[model samples]
Target: MQLHELEEFRLHAYENAKLYKKKTKRWHDKHIVSLTFEPGQLVLLFNLRLKLFPRKLQSKWSGLFEVVRMTQHGAMELKNKDKSSTFLVNGQRVKHYLRNDVDRELEALTLNDE
Candidate 1:
């Protein structure tokens, strides 16, 4: 009888562990935001591997690169503003770069017709 109880307890424990993992995963995924980029859009690239003794106050993102192309396999081709260089990077490493002038331009266009 005791052996049967132990086996049942172990099964219950395993089920509880699976439930905990599922709840944790759901909570984590809820907080994650999906990012997308388009061609001609400017973006900042994240540098995952930073140099030793890097500047403490500096941002990990570098450059306002323009999206040259996107691939079906989740790769993005980016080019510098001067068109001097290009590189293919993973889409996960890039984020949209917002410029201050964009807001000004929008306000100007909205105020023009009135």
Candidate 2:
């Protein structure tokens, strides 16, 4: 085509590319897996101190705890398997299993424009 027409096409493409990039970044940030847990859901707790509990509390499978509270920073308050003790754990430390109700609700929320 004409030189001026080609230049205009390039400019339009560049603007669309910039807009898409901005939208993609926002979507990535929004879905960074910041989630909460309910009162009875089971989770695996991560131990921060490796040396303290070597035999019994080996930083994994310490207890099949139930969630007590959903805290800020995506953390949760957990009750021990025996219902004797409670602790606050970070989202990074806990892995939530598949629950049909909660999982469906999460899936229904529309993804951000990207």
Candidate 3:
């Protein structure tokens, strides 16, 4: 009957949706990068307040905090440059701060006299 065909189509659609979700999740998890930090390394903390005040040119990360300690479960203790204050934040909420620590040699060009 027509009702039996419709039920079969619904069951097929449901199974396809479940398979799609599983494939998408596996792809996402494969691309994730795990971050590890050492003590005394500088890192930037993600600003959660940015979601409240969204701006086109505003930066999403704020502050340079030193890694004071890390817990086995992805929790980290961070301290500011002056060591004035310390706070515990999830490791997922921070990233390695990129600073130009490399020393590059500068080249000098000589001008030719006409």
Candidate 4:
């Protein structure tokens, strides 16, 4: 009788664990924001080597690269303005980079009422 009880208890524990994992996955999926990038957009790549150098007061983000294309697996191919080099990185590692005068040029080109 004791052996049967032990087996039943183990099965109950497994069920609880499975339920906990399912609940955690649902919660995590809710919090994640899906981001999409487009070609020709300027973006900055996160510097993953910051911990290697450990410089004081150094920025954690690096480089302004144009998005040449997005891979089928969601990786982005980026190149600098000079097009000297290009590299592929996961989309999560990059963010859109906005210039200080991004809106200035659009505002400057006003249509005249003729």
Q: What residue runs in model 2 are displaced by over 4 Å at the alpha carbon?
A: 1-31, 51-61, 97-114
Residue 93 miss distance in model 2 (angstroms): 1.2
Report model 3's TM-score to 2 decimal places. Answer: 0.77
Q: Which regions in candidate 4 have their CA more than 4 angstroms from the true location?
A: 50-56, 102-114
Tens-digit lDDT string for candidate 4 (16-75): 999999999999999998778889899998988637558789887888899999999889
Task: Report the C-alpha displacement of residue 73, candidate 2, in angstroms.
Answer: 3.8
- Residue-level lDDT of model 3, residues 1-114, one tens digit each, is 999999999999999999999999999999999988999999999888736657889888988899999998999999999767888999999999989989999999999999
How far is 91's C-alpha from truth in model 1 (Å)?
Answer: 0.9
Alpha-carbon lDDT of model 4 = 0.88
Q: Arrange candidates by TM-score, descending.
A: 1, 3, 4, 2
Candidate 1 C-alpha lDDT tens digits along 28-82 = 9999987787899999999888588988898999878999999998899999997
Candidate 2 positional error at 18, Å:
14
| lDDT scores of the candidates, listed in order | 0.90, 0.75, 0.93, 0.88
Of candidate 1, the 10-residue stretch with the lowest lDDT total is: 102-111
**Per-residue lDDT over 71-113 for candidate 2, one digit per residue giving the tens place of the 0 to 100 score:** 6667788888776788777768787754357444344566798
Clash pairs detected, candidate 2:
none
2: Cα error in model 2, Å: 39
lDDT of model number 1: 0.90
User: How well does candidate 3 score on lDDT at residue 45?
Assistant: 91
